[model samples]
Target: MCVEEQWLTPQGIVIGTLLGIVLHVRFSPDDQQVAVCAGNKIYMLSAKNEAILAELDGHLAPVTAAEFCTWEKSMLISVSEDRTFKARKL
Candidate 1:
């Protein structure tokens, strides 16, 4: 994976469980934050340590996509199978 080659070293590997099916992943404009859409939730993670920074629980069904705003680093947009979308400011 690109994340393994670029972010992880020879001894590092991604391992764990998320909320559910991971539909999309996106990075902030500054590349300091990561947004992951899994199931019906959006998980905000730190790029440095890959730690959970926040969990956005707004969608009712599975999330389809997620992205961060280029001009505003605090803005996050998401679409879900619940037939709705949300734009939140972090």
Candidate 2:
């Protein structure tokens, strides 16, 4: 899901939301990227432009949490409502 989207100020026009209810969104350890867990998928986005760079889909159910490895920045870890865990190497 390469959402080529934009974000506005609090008083500006509202933009569309991501694919589904966002469970989690956070910056990477190096502060160069973003990870989002939503609707059984994990989205890796560019921190500078808020563009989706990658979409990870493996869980059978909605993903609950996603986080970047503090030590290894290339890895993205997530847990799903399906009772599973995954580690994606970026």
List candidate 1 stretches off by more than 4 Å. 1-19
User: Candidate 1's residue-wise lDDT over 46-82, tens digit each?
Assistant: 8777478998998999999988876877889899999
The residue-by-residue lDDT of candidate 2 on 20-52, one tens digit each, is: 888888788777777777798887777776477
All candidates: TM-score:
0.78, 0.77
Off by over 4 Å in 2: 1-16
Among the numbered candidates, top lDDT falls to 1
- Tell me the whole-model lDDT of each prediction, alpha carbons only: 0.82, 0.78
